[model samples]
Target: METDKQQKDKQQLYTDKFFESGHWLLKIRQVLIATIGWLAVIIPIVITVLAFWASFDPRVPHLWAYHEGIYEIKFIGIILIFAWVMTLIFAVSMTIIQNRKRDRIVEQWPTFNPINQKERKKTIDDFIDKRFGPKEFRENVRSYTVKPEQNLETHQIQELYAKKDLDDVD
Candidate 1:
């Protein structure tokens, strides 16, 4: 019979192999998607900041000559600001849509739902145990009985007083 440690080692090896097998492309795709998503959110903000800075800075050259006391730089800055706002709205909407799609997929396919799978649940439990150590439950020594007529605090106080009296007698 295999010892517990040996069994755990075997399971770990199996898990490592399972993750390594034929999933590198999927992992790369996930990383690329995450990077693109972050860039989509960040690029607009950076452009907006640069546009605002250019609009105020005297040293920066304007895109065109100022016409009728109206700075063309301000117009360009306003356009950039609008573009940034639209980009933010698009990113937020896409994130919400992606989340809803993922949820729908998980709901439709029970196999994709980890909570519904016993093996996945066991794997999660094992990971938790390994990461945080096994949960230690201590026995409850103080037991209290509360009647229907009395409140919980009164019952607990009465129990405490009785225990004190017993301690004094002893």
Candidate 2:
């Protein structure tokens, strides 16, 4: 029998395996997506700092020239700002789309739960053994005292089973 920890480890491995596409192109796409996400956040903060610095100080970097007196709005700053906003939107939309795709893929696959076919087979075999008795006496029910036969149809059988006396069992 597998221990709980071992079962959990197996489950983790399966979960990871399902998420990973294994293709080089898919891996590259994931890396690019992550890079864009980080850039979306970091670039804006860096731009804000640079804009602030350029506005307060006369010594502005060569990358950004003050276009107007409106708090150091430069051509480079505008371009960077536009790129940052667009990248942020792209990242969010792509993330949502990718998550939906992954969920759909997972739905198509079989359940990750570990199946105990052995245990189920053993239980079925034991029940068969008890119900049929020993191999030698299996086909010779006349040699042993048999329970009264209930001649019931399919519906009646179902009703009888449904209304069975659970309290009769130990």
Sliding window of 10 residues with minimal summed lDDT for model 1:
161-170
Tell me the lDDT of candidate 1.
Answer: 0.61
The TM-score that candidate 1 achieves is 0.31
| Over 4 Å off, model 1 | 1-22, 58-158, 165-170
Output the lDDT of residue 154, model 2.
62
- TM-score, structure 2 vs. true: 0.29
Number of the top-ranking candidate, with TM-score as the measure: 1
**Residue pairs whose backbone atoms clash in candidate 2:** none
- Residue 22 of model 1, lDDT score: 84
lDDT value, residue 18 of candidate 2: 29
The residue pairs found clashing in candidate 1 are none
Candidate 2 residue lDDT tens string, 19-133: 5667677777888999999999999777766766766687875335455634444566798999999999999999999999889987776443235345444554554466656
lDDT of 1 at 108: 75
